[model samples]
Target: MSTPGQPKDPAAYAGPLSGRRAQAARNDHAILSAARTVFLQNPHAPVAAVATAAGVGISALYRRYPGKEQLLQKLCADGLRTFIAVAERHSDAQPDPFTALKEFVRGIVDADVHALTVKLAGTFTPTPELGELSARAGTLAQEIFNRAFEAGALRADADANDIPMVFEQLTAIRLRDEARTAALRHRYLDVLMDGLRSSQGAEALSAPPPSSQELGERWIAPDAIMD
Candidate 1:
């Protein structure tokens, strides 16, 4: 028998607790994977679809996510974190700062394309947490840009803030089919990279472009028009 003042054997209790934690981790991973797959195929896919894809019951999914918005918030946060990590890794690994910047830009675009809901949700209603993630990613991007400029790989007139504008332009490319969309995105990315090069034989831009804050404010979702 255990003493009244002493605890039970830690190993005896650890088995059940560890099993529960492992199951919870598996459920979380499955739910997130299912949500990402569904969202990639159709950003407007219902929560039921995610549950079905995850092989979990609706109740189980709800128990973990509470609601669709909460699930989306988690997905967005994960995607943003991944994007920041990729940018940091590329920036640190590449010897050529310009190549690093290009890879960073490509990484962001790839993530944005895959996480369509996350990208669109930001335009309509961004949570403070989401904004914070974006700001952190932007900081890494600015560092890459500064390094490229110092290395004479990027044009002196290029603005770090223009990175978003470049992404916005890339996102505007639409096609009737996904295949064409992917192809065009790559082609345009190459064009954008060329324009960013220091060797571009053109006069320096006369004025600065709009700030990132201004761009964000201007992109508020349109409300219904009254007759």
Candidate 2:
């Protein structure tokens, strides 16, 4: 193997991709990012909306995704994987518990993952792979929550179930510019962290935090809902 920072063979993988391949990769990234933003803003939007937002031709998009369900599946899978990767990385970097928790929160916000749930949830049945990923993601997130609480970094009244709802609330804040909205959301996240931390003057929550099952029940498809 090569040194820690060096590629095993730079010539094989580090140089520019072929013109067509490089362009394809860029287009794919643009399409998926645009799809996430567009669909989250309006779940009922047409596939052509994604193409327009991505600045690519409709044919190009159809060639890659074939249909809106496929695109939604890919976007949600990407967001889930992003969450898993962030959690795994931070889990290994165990320093100050609350600081790690805050970093984890920031990483998720940067991913802007909760938007997928806020709008596109239940739009398509999840694939088996997506189901597996969701299971792993939940485990990692709860581990992070447990670590903070066990270390007394997090407040007793703040349960792990509060995490998703807080992130979802952030997703509801829309602005004309993405960067501006992110900045505002992050500013408020700092305020949230202060409240979450265990403090002498912390007040008890008015009600119990949502249970994990209840938080999860929100994603159940309309067909699966019961009286």
Candidate 3:
């Protein structure tokens, strides 16, 4: 069965696999799922922690991912895919702009996208593939925000560039129980959503909306990104 951090298509990996390779695929799934948990809890964690968490030998973990940087890249690439999928799904299918935006926000939160951001940002220099996917995700997110803004749903003061920072703000609600942590994120997200809606008497933002370049600068050109 599919689990968090596992590739979406389990059966069709790198063409058909021999029995031994099939076992390796299964081990890969376990390794990714465990790594997600271990690293999210602690980004600076040693590689052995992932091996122990995955219930695999250290050698097996290394064989699958040459190093922690590779592992971080894979995890983030998976998260960006999820983020893009949710944005794409809601970008056109929903008729109500605000509702669509809310659902998209909820989907990403459910996917634990913010947790990945809170835990893993800057942990590795992203490969070119990851960088491309990140840019795609950002474009989709902006499209979603623009739709809401054009429809007079989202506040005029906030723009798509604010989305990442907004999600990062919500990532502060960590708790011992992951479920509770998720619940709290949604709870605050709902509050933030209310503030984001266009409404009378909502003061003009004291500061100018952040430029895309400002946010883009955070992810070094030498690398890749979030939200």
The numbered model that scores best in TM-score is 3
lDDT of 2 by residue, 88-132 (tens): 888748688888888888778777777675577767778899889
How do the predictions measure up, each by TM-score?
0.68, 0.84, 0.85
With candidate 2 superimposed using the best TM-score fit, by how many Å does residue 20's alpha carbon deviate from the native? 4.1
lDDT of 2: 0.79
Candidate 2, RMSD to the unseen true structure: 5.4
RMSD (CA, Å), each prediction? 10.1, 5.4, 4.1
Residue 26's lDDT in candidate 2? 66
Count of clashes in candidate 1: 0
Which parts of model 3 have CA positions greater than 4 angstroms off?
Answer: 1-18, 221-227
Locate the minimum summed-lDDT window of 10 residues in model 1.
1-10
lDDT of 3 by residue, 1-227 (tens): 46433465447565888898888887788788888888877888998998998789999999989999898888888888888888888887789988888778877776776677547765677789988998899888888888899999978787776677667777767788978988898998899888889998888887876787776565553244333
lDDT of 1 at 169: 81
Question: Candidate 3: global Cα-lDDT?
Answer: 0.79
Tell me the lDDT of model 3 at 10. 44
